[model samples]
Target chain A: MRIGIYGFGSIGRLVAREAVKRGWEIVGAIDIDEKIIGKDIGEILGFEEKYGVVVSRDVEELIDADVVVHATSSYLDKVYDQILSLVRLGIDTVSTCETLSYPYYRYPVLARKLNEEALRYGVTVLGTGINPGFLLDTLPIVLTAPFNIVEKIVAKRSLDASKRRKSFVEKIGIGMDPEEYMKALREGKLTGHVGYAESVYLIADAAGIHLDKVEERQEPIIADKDMIIGEFKVRKGEVIGIKGYGTGYKNRKEIIRLEFHAYLGAKEYEEIMVIGTDYEVRWRSTGTPGDQGTVAVVLNIANIINDLSPGLLLMTDIIPFKPFFKH
Target chain B: MRIGIYGFGSIGRLVAREAVKRGWEIVGAIDIDEKIIGKDIGEILGFEEKYGVVVSRDVEELIDADVVVHATSSYLDKVYDQILSLVRLGIDTVSTCETLSYPYYRYPVLARKLNEEALRYGVTVLGTGINPGFLLDTLPIVLTAPFNIVEKIVAKRSLDASKRRKSFVEKIGIGMDPEEYMKALREGKLTGHVGYAESVYLIADAAGIHLDKVEERQEPIIADKDMIIGEFKVRKGEVIGIKGYGTGYKNRKEIIRLEFHAYLGAKEYEEIMVIGTDYEVRWRSTGTPGDQGTVAVVLNIANIINDLSPGLLLMTDIIPFKPFFKH
Candidate 1:
């Protein structure tokens, strides 16, 4: 298989590394980083041997591949043109964009346009990752397969912020006053997490249930005692990280709830509870690596995206959740 | 969609109930039970009204259905002719026979013949249930999606026989002399469980790894103290139930291990641990209903069997475990 890597950041590099191990040809590398442009892909990947492919700003560099993995940004607006440009070139794309996981949830107009363009050009497109893509939505849908009916769903993903890298920890507004963190978050100066609504709708849509209400919020998880977390010193009643949640309702009855948590010294694991009439099952995971899991999801979908129907599709569209779909 | 039920036992009735809830048309019911034959399915199901379809010994009753769920016996030898007769009538089938999950494991010749016949008649045939199908095999494959390289896998399904029906508890040889239970089990008078080898092979096939050795064993779980279980009285040193295991080795190194425990007081849950190089993750589930899960597996696969290629397939074949396949 021949593949290309777009947006050569942490995730893109991870994909390239795993792809090479599979013996797939890395046809091209597309990135806007001025520092890496014009360098051999092998050098940027820290390999002693240089691959013929070079990191280039031109999208055409990826035109020769069977599929181009677009891992640009979280929001749809930020990566809209980049993904469309690839679609215009008639290339199948398995992107890591969080919003694109459920484009219609927040970008109905753009999603429709992208779908039309994909159909016109005859290429497939998908957006997925560990959170909006699997842990929160896809896994829950799979768990509901054994039930004749599903009444409600609750999922929580908790990862220790102290274990994450510096850039990822910074986004959660670590080690700040709880009130100040909320104020900055309200003013749009900080970004806690994204794709809560996407996951809520993804689960509901797969269940074929229409939601009357969907709401999301992010809050600070204050440390209760003096302790050390990474480089942070002792403190009490201070913001350590954030806990975000999304809730969906049907006819004023709660149907779905998803929680995303990342805090210093937090327990790292994911739990999903799916309840049916007189039945309930909980599926828990021994935490997943965010960036590593993103690489896996993107490449796994890339392996089969070419065989799927052409259009802008969600992860649930091709994951084969037929049992829930029947409901 | 129209469907048919080939066995009117516990699983068949469960499937019929859920299928009706989906509003599917239950075209016919076929069974060899002399007492139930010729009776209206609805009446036998304890419904207030009668369904026109009647239980019969003839396969023609299922000819009109888009798919037929064949849930008679566990071993392939017992149900091969039954399934082939349906395939001859150009009807797709989803069977709950445990041995048929990986037909080639114990019946390679029969598996190959069934595949040829399925292709000749252009229909899909699948064998699936909770143990051989999902909990031990399919679910583990799905959990391996995030890893770059997997080294070993261990899955366990532990259920409390005390909470199960009497018939189920009887099969586990509850309250029997440990020595007598072992002798009876060896002499074929008692059947504890089947499908360990099938699950091992299914996992191996998805990971694209060939096994050098596969071994399975069933041992009695002796009671440690006197206690009441259901209607039976167990004393210390008596057999409470059984603990079965299957292990697969590659090049003298163990690669897969699966344990199935059904004892009077066993903890009720399922757990799967997949370890990759420098990475490991565990997925656990609250206890799943064996019979209900079988019904779900059959119907879920039946829902999409028509769209699949014509042949005998395993759960791994359709569940989409590309990440593992890449290995």
Candidate 2:
């Protein structure tokens, strides 16, 4: 399959490398930066040029490819117009964009617009990645396989986010004034991603439960003392980490627990648990260095686009309980 | 202590009888029903007159007591002003009124106003009962005792409503059209108890977690066959039960799950579970006929009023996990 990758930054470049290794053809790469455009994709990631495909600034120039892989940053509010453009061109698309995964939960009107556009174009659109997509959607479904009678489902993904990008660190209010961090949180400006509620909604849909309410909550950085990160000294009242949690309840009973935590320079772990009438199942996995799990999820799904059903799908709709690739 | 029982209904009469048995002085009883005014409290509950306390429709006259126990029905919106009036009169009060437990969660502005009035009057105001107040508040704290490291807390209270009052049966949508029930649920009009969110919030506060988000959800009643009760025949599409759930998440992690379920003519059961680092503790209690558990909680707390700290308190704030009265 000839694929075009939009946003040829870190994750996008990694996806390109993985796709090449899997024998998929890279038609071209699209990036917003003019300097990066027309450059060999391998050269951007410090690899010797092998595939002759050059990065293009023009999105329309890459529309002829069989699939468009969107590995853009978390600034998804701006990407909707581009995705809609692709939909208008009748191009099949898959995104690792955080907000688009479950747009309806956060950006309801935009999500609806995207869904309608995708349907109108008759092309499938999918949003999948580590946190919102996999933990919320895929993990819950995997945990429920053994239980014919599921009483509740709780999934938690905790990350030592110090190794993450600077954007992530700032978004979670790490190494910032606690009061300011809290103010941003209350205003919803600091919500790093928007799919926590969407994930709960997707799981409830899969579980055959019609929920009357859905709620999301966050835990701000409550640091005992301040420390320095990247040359800036944070004070005692400053935040060094933050946690976000979303839950779905059945009949005023908690049926699903979706939690996400990111800490500056800490150990990372992910767990998914389901409570049922007969038994309970839990899956815990450690994240690789530098948020490699995020890269792995994107690549894993990229390799199986053919096997997946057409249309917009969440992570739970695609991820398998067992690891996708055997060592 | 001189105490007046307001709203001489089932719960109020039960409180009066229990108080009489404990040798506590019953100042009087009050109800909205004019027909019941001036009647002996004993005659209201089919018992012989012994306390010489008469039931009256005059709420103002009843507020003269040192304490007034408000055990009114669910129409708290109508009585909130009256309750506030009594609180302003400097009466130390305990209420089983459904909406009083967490006025902040349900009616925030009113709860705050009442709180201010109670503080200004130097009087204590408390709301307590079996389900929303005790099961959600006291039970969670009790379950957390064994675990030094609590990762999450989940509480579930399920009751078979066959033995419930006629008002409860109608409110829960038992023997009602399912479509209409669902419509009411969507409109938020069918929310039977608004205190579920308050219960979760109170528990979260006790746990010392600053919750970023709290969400509530409900489930529709689904039955494969029609249910017949008395002269009312509920179709399969009609709701026979309802479930309400509230969850509090800290740092995007699931920390507390509070749930309540009511069914018409149903068996009663309550369970509290605390998931901690070292161990998980679960307590399940079954009720005898006529919601004896509800009476137990009220009577237990009343017996220890002298031992309690001098202030307003919820069921959890006053009642110890141990037996109220040793056998």
Candidate 3:
């Protein structure tokens, strides 16, 4: 199958390389980054050979591709036009947009428009990734297939921030003081993880459960003593990393919760606890790499996007088992 | 939704009770037991209140139910006529029949005919339960959504035989002589577990992986010393329980494996290991009750069976995700 990569960011590059590794043809690539716009896709992906597919800034270059893997942004509103253009081109596209995983929770208006636009053009547009699409949300829903009645759900992902990419560490404010980190977070300077409530809503909606309120928050993790992590050093009583949480409530009682932790020296693991009537299933895994996990989810999704109905869809629409549906 | 229970045995009764508790109407029930054929389902379920729905051997009484939950047998061939009758009546149905979960592997001709019949009548027919339907097969496939390329999968379910019902203990040939257990198993007096290859085929089919060969085996687990377990006494070297395995291979390399253990004093848990290109994920959970698990799976499927397209659908076709597909 011919494929296209639209973001050319770290995730996009990884997807292009993996798609090629899977023996699929890379038809074209689109990126706004001038540094690599005219370069061969092979060189950009650090391959020994050139793929002969050059990175272009024009979305039209991907017109002939069967599917385009969009890894540009996290919010549906921000990438609304980018996805809209791809839909009009009649290309099946799966994205890494966090909010798009459950757009109605945050962008009901835009979601309606996209759904209509995609149906008109007869193309499928999907948003999925590791956390919002799988681990913290979709996995929980799938794990609950054996449950009689789900009462509460808690899904968690904890990663070592020091081991992540430099950009990720900087985004979470690894070297900032506690007060400074809080100030920056409040001022939108140091944004922590996104898509907590997206995960919560996705799981809740898949289970046919309702929540009156959904909330998300992030805070800095303070260090006790000086330590060196990666290329950075931490002082006593300073910020080490970030911890974030999302919770869903109904009638003033919590029904779903999601936890994301990325800190130096953090134990890496993913846990999903599903508490149902007369049974509780707790599934814990040795954590997966976020960057590679996205590539896997996207590529795996690309293989089946053509089979899906044309519309703005989420991971729930494509998974092959019967999810809870109230008839 | 109005429901019908076919084969008001243990699983069927449990489903009836759970459905009533969920506020769904138990319109009718069918069972072959002459003693309870004319009895009220509520009383048979030990509920003080009468539901006014009587258990009858005639399938015609359940023609009005929106859906029927069939728990008669494990083999699809044995229940083919029963399921086909429900389809002909224009009612959706979900069954706990083990091989029916992936009938193409065992009864290809019946599967095709059933699919056509269900489609002709505009009703969905499904086969699902805890073992073949969820843990060993569907759960493993769901857990691999985050992986890029799944190279191998291993799923295991271990339960305590002593905690299960007397019939289950007898089915596994617990407290029998080792040689007698083997003879009984060979003579078909004791059938340890059904649906190993069915689970293998279901998971393999979902993951879009091809296995050239599939094999299954069961053996008795012997006791080392004198012991007492659940109203039974065991001598040294006697049978305590059973262990079974199913394996799928591609080019003689194992790609999928399933393990089932129901032994006295066994640690109860479920584990699924997904080994992919560059990552491996292991999800272990506290054990779920088998009888109740079947009830949960059937009820959950009952809630969504109407949403599914009319066909002899397995768990794979109705699940709500883009299971791997090769374009």
Query: How far out, in Å, is residue A277 in model 3?
Result: 1.9
lDDT by residue (A1-327, candidate 2, tens digit) is 677888888778877775665467888788888888788877877776556878888888777678888877554577887777777877778787777776666677877777777777787777766655655576456434333345777777667655667666777877767778778878867865456787887787655467768888777766666666544466777677777777876677777778877775555655666564534545444432323445445544554454445566665444222111001
Q: What shift in Å separates residue A23 of candidate 2 from its native position after superposition?
A: 3.6
Best by DockQ: 3
| Local accuracy of candidate 1 as per-residue lDDT tens digits, A2-76 | 998889887888899988987889998899999999999899889999999889999998888899998878889
Residue A61, model 3: lDDT of 96
Task: List all candidate RMSDs to the true structure.
Answer: 2.5, 23.0, 2.0
- DockQ of each model against the real complex? 0.53, 0.01, 0.56
lDDT of 1 by residue, B119-207 (tens): 99998999988888888888887777777667888999999888877767778898899889999989977889788999999999877
Question: Which structure is stronger by lDDT: 2 or 3?
Answer: 3
> What TM value does chain A in model 1 reach?
0.95
DockQ, model 2, C-alpha based: 0.01
Where is model 1 more than 4 Å wrong at Cα?
A176-180, A183-189, A223-227, A234-238, A323-327, B323-327
Off by over 4 Å in 3: A320-327, B320-327
DockQ of 3: 0.56
